[model samples]
Target: MKKILYLLLLVSIMTSCGEYNKILKSTDYEAKYEYAKNAFEKKKYTQAYTLLEELVTIFKGTDKAEESLYLLARSHYLNKDYETSGQYFTHYYTHYPKGQYTELARFYAGYGYYLNSPEAKLDQSGTYKAIDEMQRFLDYFPHSERAKEAQDVIFELQDKLVYKELLNSQLYYNLGNYMGNNYQSAVITAQNAIKEYPYSKYKEALSMIILKAKFQEASQSVYEKKADRFRDVIDEYYSFINDYPDGPNAKEAKDIFRVANKYVKE
Candidate 1:
């Protein structure tokens, strides 16, 4: 019985492959197009896009062109070939501005990149592209049903960028005064991150970094500059504590504040 089932399964697979090959080699465009649509519906994304890629060009200027292009893009997206999908999606909307699937094409174009966005530790070009594309979608379709989702994606990608900057700031802070005053660099990077993403979830963390970097910078300064630098640290501590009275880093912040105050006992 198991042998029979195995033979049956192998035969079914062979038949399916043979049918796909026949359709792929066929000269009839309509049959190929219909088969591609069916393949996509069945979630055979690679097969669907392989056929649709050809039909999109063949059907250009015809009624099938719009849908063929959109389907091709959608197939790539579902296949997780996001970079390729983004290109095809962009092409679809550009050529079919008023086409039936334009709205979806736009949304997927950006959302695909969002899915492709790398980790915060990696280069953020893809993340930036995702945010830019999502913003463009909002501008074009503010009332679109997908508008809320697009906006949310943009915010999420922006937060990723802020987090990347936070990592850089932390790196600088950890380096301390190695070779030069990386603590100041840390403070600057953290400050810029705060200014750019004031509402980020990382905002409190950034503020804490600023306060900590200022403390370190003051601690390492020459005796003549220590008093003035510590005063800056005290001011940063107040700003941090004011915004985040119960922030996660409050205890360490208090310790820094105490040390900073002791230094400036003028």
Candidate 2:
């Protein structure tokens, strides 16, 4: 019985494939549209995308245009072709501002970028684009059911930007006074990151970097600049502790402060 069932399933699949191929070659737009919908429903996104791609322009300005365009975007999204999906979604919203799928198009256009955002080590243009899209979604649909999710994604993307800056700052710190004053560069980078992402989870780490960078900068300065630079390090250490009394780097910060205090007179 199982063998017979399997044979029947194989025959059904072959017949379905044959019919789909026939439909693909036909000029019958209505038939193609119906088949595309069915293919999408069956999760055959590649087939659906192929069929919809042909019909979207044909159905333009027709009653089927809105749904056809939206389906084209969704098919790409379902296929995990997020970049392509984002483009289609943007097209849909731009053309059909008040269409039935406008909300979804706006949300997914940005959400697709978020889904495709690369790691912190990689270029983060996609992450920034995602944040822009999601922020626009919030501005347009503040009460949308997906608003909170969009907001959360924005926060996550911002964190990624902060982390990238953190890595840059650390690199500068590691370079130290290799050829020039890299510690100054590290302090500037960390301070900018702290200002840009005041609520970032990396806030403490950035502050710590600033303090350490200042100490190193002072330590390596010429005798004429050492006392004033060390005093700057002491001020940075106090500000770091004020913000995070029990911070993970408290011990290190305090030790640096103790050393810096020895250089600057009361």
Candidate 3:
């Protein structure tokens, strides 16, 4: 009985493949499209897109063009080809402003990139693209059902950029003044991140870095500049504490302030 069941299953697989091949060879584009749509419904993404690739162009200017293009993009998205998905989705909305799938395409075009956004230490071009796409989606569909989700994603991606800047700032601080004024670089980077993403969760981390960098820069300054630089450090500590009066880094910040205040006094 098991052997009989196995034979039936094998036959079913072969017959299915044979039918798909027959459809592939047929010139009946409508039949091919029907089969692709069915294939997609059955989760045969590769087979779905294999036919969709040609049909999208063939159906251009026809009633089916909008749907076929959108399906092609969605197929790529399900297959985890985010890069290709993003391109096709962009194309879909660009060509069909009021098309049935325009809103969905716009949403996924950016969301897919957000899903593929790289780590903070890596290149952030994709993250930037994701932010741009999500922003565009919000601008065009402010009242969409997906509007809240898109807005949240935009904030998350922005935070990723902030995290990247935080890492850069930390790197500069670590380098100290090896061959240049890296502490100053660290301060500049962190400050710019704060200015751009004032509401980011990393604002506290960035502020801490700025305060630390300022202290380091002042502590290492030449004798004549020490008094003036420490005064600057005192100013930064006050600013950091004012913003994060009870933040996690408060203890360290106050320690720095004590040293800075005492130095300026002497």
Candidate 1 lDDT score relative to the true structure: 0.92
What is the clash tally of candidate 1?
A: 0
Question: Model 2 over residues 1-266: C-alpha lDDT tens digits?
Answer: 99999999999999999999999999999999999999999999999999999999999898698899999999999899999999999999999999999999999999999999999989999999999999999999999999999999999999999999999999999998899889889989988998988999999999998999889888888999999999989888889999999978999999999999998974
Cα lDDT for residue 1, model 1? 100
Error of 2 at 174 (Å): 0.9
| Residues 157-180 of candidate 1: C-alpha lDDT, one tens digit per residue | 999999999999999999987899
Task: List candidate 2 stretches off by more than 4 Å.
Answer: 1-6
lDDT of each: 0.92, 0.94, 0.95
- Lowest lDDT block of 10, candidate 1: 212-221
Off by over 4 Å in 1: none
Q: Which candidate should be chosen as best, given lDDT against the real structure?
A: 3
> Which candidate comes out best when scored by TM-score?
1
Candidate 3 C-alpha lDDT tens digits along 118-153: 998999999999999999999999999999999999
Report how far off residue 37 is in candidate 3 (Å). 0.5
RMSD of 2: 1.4
